[model samples]
Target: MPSSNDSRVERARIVASFGRQFYVRTLDAPGPDRVAVTRGKRTDFCVGDEVTIRLIGADQAVIERGLSRRSELIRSDRYNVKRLAANVDQAAIVIASDPRFSEELLLRMLLACATAEIPALILANKSDLATAWAAIAPRLQVYRDLGYPVIELAARDHPQETRAALSRYLTGHNTILLGESGMGKSTLVNTLVPGAALATREISAALCAGRHTTTFSKWFDLPSETAPSGAIVDSPGFQTFGLAHVSDSQRVHAMPEYTELIGGCRFHNCSHIQEPGCAIRAALESGAIDPIRYLLFSRLAGRD
Candidate 1:
């Protein structure tokens, strides 16, 4: 029996957002239900935000303030930036064999993960597609070689294996699930968190794209035998993951493999493309850097 208050404050987490309304789970409550909350007109909130709220009714609350975020995941377009989730422990990037995997997009995601100081786990879904899987195996290997955890399995076909591989990361941290539409991210979520019942759709063979099933982002708590409190932020599929917030230096720093040669470049502002005595180019030729990655850096940095 909670009462409305003018001065009382309670800690909570924003588990979901709907326009001006937010669904928050109160940490102060003994119950597990969420209460609808609203914030000041200028204040914004995203999934996984820890907030302080004051009760207005039995089932309603007003957010007083959001706690400082430990981490934030954002999506940007040319004009605006959209915060996807906050307090992320890691990013589980899902990709598949069909519709031709985009190496450039994967690199961008990895860069985003790296810049945010979030670890990345690459999952190659649809491994049941033998031909498609075979084609991408080499690229997947490259990611594995670079030290990011990589796992390949069709969620539906290898549920046990997939679960085992993901359990280590999913058991104790708040991971954000990200991928292009039709890449089976929702399906994987369904497999990870039983009773999630997230809607999923098949990829259109004609377009090789999946229907957008998830309309918004929400946090799902994963209760496993090992870690009952682990959670993941499920996000809608993205056609493009924008990095408008990341600066040139941050982008460069995100490339972990390039760290060793960063200060070795001939010029402090060397574009890493067509620059005389560029350390990156030297590393590319010396087999110290992955050629594919260097090419992606060149293109993403807008180098000739």
Candidate 2:
């Protein structure tokens, strides 16, 4: 049994940085002032640790530890094991309406979250544009049909309204901003966190996207009177959030609708593509499955 004080300080913490001299993590201790600082040793810590700590005098100390993470958002970048975020209860996958939205990649990311068994919400940004709203509306509808919550928002304008809609998911859970170059992930994070003025950049014509503003993964604290739930982390601009490490089963399981169709795929080893009796192929042809998503799914399932 845990003590009353022990349970009182059980709010989750996020690993900030592990340096040669010290370790740092983000915590909402002493309520949602978002100023609780957790520090320990390098060997004793790694970035993205969801830990428990107690307030001593001036600093926070690690006390009883929580269970290690059941899953994480990890990917290989240049042969380095880059940890995206830890203890992600959900991911607010951001897609911009500015340069046009690609539902293909969006579905790919949602599938990745499903592969990891994490819930995901799709945030369609740049809704201020008239042309974009029309295109984004259908894309948003498509994801909603797939049973994922979708929101069309413009961060630079209506920050408060967007904040309220997203606040419920961020409480006590780490959320990663998964988006392309120009979708304003960094800007949004800076706004969410009080004093953080993270770097920002504009879309480039040469690449037809926003320039990479964030260089690496960093943690931020959120302001809330209760347990802090508005926290967010900003990651570097990634053109391709590759899913090579995930299994084929994860790719299929990520799509809620595919559960009924996976077993129906032909040959038991059906590639779900070009296989004559593949259920996925038939569904795509009959307009039952979104062709864009099916195409991305086949690629990740190694059928491409």
Candidate 3:
């Protein structure tokens, strides 16, 4: 804790955020993390944000303002835009073989990452479930063909293999884990960061919420031996991920397979939905593009 009279503005990184309350670690000095709050109703801050703060007490501070973000992941519906995290180097979209993951939600997350210009990889968890793994293997191959690295691992059943497979991607990067509920993301986080459960408990105590009430995002520093110079953010699992913030043109260009064929449409402003001379439709018909992905595009573009 800093002296109350020392009113110097210092740099800090937000480690946890629960609604308007935040926990920030000082980047400028060695001290315990301070409880932080904004001066007004500005609740746009998210975990992993680098911000400036001024200490008001020994254990609390006021967030002055945020620094420039390197990257930000956001999801939006017609009513609201939710910021997930900021300053993330990459994102890992965790999906499971069992429980039948939604391809629509997965595609929306990928597009959100693409629109944010952040690199993303797919983690096909639950590979130990042989029957389910066999069923989802081919669908996972489609993403691999599109150039997204898809790593298969069983986070709970094979912790060693899971850690080994994710080490290369997690090392030296600030990664955010994105997944729908029951995808083993929490297990993965505990496997990667042994202290994650404890941290979660601490956060729960601080917020006076139940242990299972994951209403906030929390950041964990990776063990040096496992992933030096790296950190991971565990976000609340959600059933829906919207992309109302993404424009129609942005969505089209975000698809890797559609980029090359974007300007080949007859009309310069082709919607790629029903235009007769649309190159995307031609590619879909010729099997150059995955039909599932094409259909997903139509649905996301509100054409379906």
Best by lDDT: 3
- What's the TM-score of every candidate structure? 0.88, 0.74, 0.94
Q: Give every collision pair in model 2.
A: 170-229, 171-229
lDDT accuracy of residue 92 in candidate 1: 92
Q: Across residues 155-183, which tens digit of lDDT does each residue of candidate 1 receive?
A: 97777777887887788799898888778
The list of candidate 3 runs beyond 4 A from truth reads 1-8
Better of 1 and 3 by TM-score: 3
lDDT of 3 by residue, 112-187 (tens): 9999999999999988899988999999999999999999888997888888888888999999999888887778
Better of 1 and 2 by lDDT: 1
Against the reference, the lDDT scores of all candidates come to: 0.78, 0.64, 0.88
Number of the top candidate by TM-score? Answer: 3
Which runs in model 2 stand beyond 4 Å of their true positions? Answer: 1-23, 26-47, 50-67, 77-80, 198-212, 225-230, 301-304
Cα misplacement distance, residue 143 of candidate 3 (Å): 0.2
- Cα RMSDs, all models: 4.8, 7.4, 2.0
> How does candidate 3 score on lDDT?
0.88
